[model samples]
Target: MKRLLLLGVLLAVSSTAHAIVIRHDVDDAKYRVPATEFPALVDMPGEGHGALIAPQWVLTAAHTLPMHGDLKQVVINGAARDVERVVVHPGYRTLPQTLIDQAMASGEAMLIVVFLASGDDVALIRLKAPVTDVAPVAIYSGTDEAGQIAKILGKGATGTGATGHSPSGPNRTELRRAFNTITSAYDRWLCYVFDEPPQALPLEGVLGNGDSGGPVLIERDGQWLLAGQGAWKVVQGNVLTARPGRYGQVTCNVRVNHYRDWIERIMAEPAQTTAVG
Candidate 1:
């Protein structure tokens, strides 16, 4: 069995952002997409990404928000939208620094996995005004997420699976789309492996730095549904030396269906005080 190390790719202001890493044989240009293609995909604070699930609500990962203050605004439809409020799931909690340090020092992979799985990694942003130009994506409520082919969109760092993520890649801000099949589904995570060559999709890839809070979408009845939120990457062996965004690594996204009720309840509320869990 392979030991897995769960690492968060959450972007911060001073850090560099990475997009999807593609197959070495494929053209990098093939992965690029127009910004108009994914209008619901918005830019979150700290260079993270989010999807608009409702006209007034944007769904994202809680960790992407600042630790000190409320996320005051987000870029939606290429325009800045004032945030009315932000609500992180009450069940969400960050692992203590002490425990994380211990896990890293002891090389205990399961300790990190169990702690991450136990927490809700989702959050919702309420916009002061409802967006009418771009249609919002619906949350996938079905239980059949495993084995589904998902389309991941991001505009961060870029590199090939053969080389992992490169810090010197050109213009790490182009919107790109890649495909991957969900290999496993837990109550809180959807895991997928990055395969090379014959086993990989024509444009197979995985998220890199700065893609946290991005959407993993599945098509249903000609409509795209939000199935997961980009959260963490699982690397095999010693995490300290592990090169992320490479073949054989796993990308685990926050399973969206598990918190559908929580999303609905928060959206239904007339107003919510800004809270971070």
Candidate 2:
């Protein structure tokens, strides 16, 4: 019996995948984001994605922002805050054309130039007035060791072939649950939710458009730590069921473990680059 229990735990650990399903590019929504939660999301000028991880810092995808409003302001929940800094990952290429090429080639290892969901993609921000209300998420960088269960939260869109802007609605980050196994874990890797129970998220319930730049958490014991950020999700055209539509990929939260130093270094730098090169 003891051996069986041990084996079960091992099996559980062995089967945990970490690929995130993130989406971008879409019109307005049919439904409304939660009221309590609505205050946390700030709208970027050019229309990318936004999520409040801490009272001060907003998390988001690097490539979403336009050069204009990089990281200028932050509206928490509803109240707006003036931007003080911008931080992009050092490794992220500033040019959009280059980023496009990289994405087309391997579909792995995205070097996002962090733009503060506002003026510039900010990895972290120092608020003008310290906000002690919402707790800041802890980021893990040293070990995304293969075979670890990772949890994620985001604001994915709804609606199927409802492809046009008219067919969707704003789905806020209510801390949804999606699990997968670690297929390959390197600088950047993939995870499969199929191996886990609840094979896939419902067609409309899965993380789609607004979910970009969210967190994929890794729960150890009773606590949760930030592991990956919502990146991409596969969508199918004229689809009835939820499937990884061809050319559609469930990509989110690039796992940041094994790079604790990078996070620390970025946090320590003058909010300059969004991605860590």
Candidate 3:
């Protein structure tokens, strides 16, 4: 389970691998992303990816943005969008770089692990201009989605690697999609296990660096609902043993269902809706 332990340790790895698609045998083009779907790709100015949830609002992982201050500039799919407001989940907490450094200095992986699994990594970006052209995906607010198939989209690494091993090269720049079964669903998170090479599913993949803030979508009765956002990738053990080349990586997605009320409230507030950044 990627839960909290794996996410904490995986964050310590090099950002070059950002996110991954573990099976080298998979075709990258077949998973080509729709031009109008999953529209936010924070390739430059910022590092992670994102998705549009409203005409003028974008949703992503909080870590994708700077700790404090407005995002002066954000490029989504080549077009620059000024961020007016940033709303991070109050409970979202990741081990800061300074804390990570302290943990490394003291060899305290447990402390970092405990902090990373708080399960609140989501954030909302109010765009300066309305993105009315692209239709926003509806958020999922129904029952538990365990065992359901979901699509994970990103512009991450296409190469495969084990848990404790580092990627052999830089991550791919093209947008990609992979399918995974929701192994488990917690109150605030959804977990999906990425299969290793010799994949059981033709489209099975994992996450690396640039994949953060990407969308995890679920389809129901022909409607694709936004269920979660890419947060972290984890292996079973801690940094010392959870090598990338090792098999079994669990990808954690911040569950959208648990925060629907908060999202709705934020969207409805006009005062917090200005494009200031």
Which candidate should be chosen as best, given TM-score against the real structure?
A: 1
lDDT of 3 by residue, 1-277 (tens): 1222223234333222334464556555666666454654444343566777887878777777764566766676567777777887777665566756664455446545456566477778887788755677788876677888888777654555433334333444666677778888888778777666565467776556556667788998888898887776654544544444234666777788888888888888775654421
Candidate 3 yields a Cα-based lDDT of 0.63
Superior by TM-score: candidate 1 or candidate 2: 1
- Strongest candidate by lDDT: 1
**RMSD of each candidate relative to the true structure:** 4.3, 12.2, 4.3
Superpose all Cα atoms of candidate 3 onto the true structure and report the RMSD in Å to 1 decimal: 4.3
Model 1: ten consecutive residues of lowest lDDT? 7-16
Ranking by lDDT: 1, 3, 2
Kindly list the per-residue Cα lDDT of model 2 for residues 57-170, writing each as its tens digit. 655445444455556665555466666655555544333455334533544212321221112222444455544555555665445446666544444433322222111224
| Model 2 CA RMSD to the hidden true structure, in angstroms | 12.2
Better of 2 and 3 by TM-score: 3
Name the regions of candidate 3 deviating beyond 4 angstroms. Answer: 1-19, 32-37, 40-44, 94-99, 106-108, 161-172, 197-199, 237-242, 272-277
